[model samples]
Target: MTSFAQSERAGLCDTFLEVGPDAPTLCSDWRARDLAAHLILRERRPDAAIGMFLAPLAGRTDRIQASLAQRPFEELVDTIRSGPPKWSPMALGSIDEAANFAEFFVHHEDVLRGVDPSARRQLDAAEQKAIFAALPRIGMLSLRSCRVGVVADAGSYGRRSLRSPKDDHGNVVLTGEPGEILLHIFGRTAVTDVELDGADHDVESFRKTDLGT
Candidate 1:
């Protein structure tokens, strides 16, 4: 069976082809071609991927990524679709899913929703469960900037107190599917359907805060 990470990677490649290189994406200023180059660099050139998170190394990473972006867009997408090479840790079957699922899921949506905000993917049951299971840990990291506390209500999957309520900030209830909630937490609030139920101030504060990297 194809893992969710693998499926997302394949689907993203197909989307890149459909939209073409110049297509815009939810990722800041990156076009489809640029996002493709970033993915390839992240997986194939681990040395520079750190720039993705660290500030000081970003210039080097950007230079390398720009160089990679100059490659034919389709070729870059093909490199991502083909999966990591044998020498990379991502090539290990045991680590692939854990390593790529959230990364691919978010970036996949970034590409899709960049063009059509309402284009949300309907994830499978197993995928939802797996993602829901990961919510608490990632929720903490992603929502670190939120002024209000969050309770993720994933319907039947379960509910989690993503962050403890601050005395002054209050708490917000985020009601939605695992996938939608994930997007919202990752600073894609405008495109997500996750309903925010809370006091007026809390809801507004939640929306105003920037979440995730």
Candidate 2:
């Protein structure tokens, strides 16, 4: 079976090429070319990739990404479509599956959903399972700073605590298909359709929380 990672990567690259370099994306201020450069840098430039998590290094990362953005658009698209070079750690099978599945899935949506009057993509069970498998880590990464508790309830698949009640704020249980939950976690809350069950205050806060890019 083709892995979700591989599927999403191909889809994302195709969309990037189809849309061309100047097209808008859901990612704030990023055009198709910019997004392609980002994927390439994250996979190929280990030293610069650290900036993704380090605020101090972000400026340097941005400079490098901008320089890369100036490369021939077709070359950038080809690099993204091909994925990480053989020498990179992400080139390993297991690591690539773990890391790229959600990355490419989210980015694929970023391109597709950015268009006017966008419709949600139809995800298969295997793709949903891939996103769900990464939920614990994604939940912690995106929601750790929020004041509400998050339980990603993937029925029959299992329930995982994304977070505990950070304060007196009520706990919010997010029950939905893994793809919807992934959209919410990635800060596309306004466009996502998921069951948000909790106090109004908590739900509102959760929606407003800066969940990152």
Scanning candidate 1 in windows of ten residues, the lowest lDDT window is 92-101
Model 2 residue 176 distance off true place after TM-score fit, in angstroms: 2.8
- What value of lDDT does candidate 1 attain over all alpha carbons? 0.89
In order, candidate lDDTs are 0.89, 0.84
Q: Which residue pairs of candidate 1 clash?
A: none
Model 2 lDDT per residue over 93-114, tens place:
7888888888888888888887
CA shift of 40, model 1, Å: 1.1
TM-score of each: 0.92, 0.92
Q: What's the C-alpha lDDT at position 6 in model 2? A: 81
Model 1 off-target regions past 4 Å?
Answer: none
Query: What is the TM-score (0 to 1) of candidate 2?
Result: 0.92
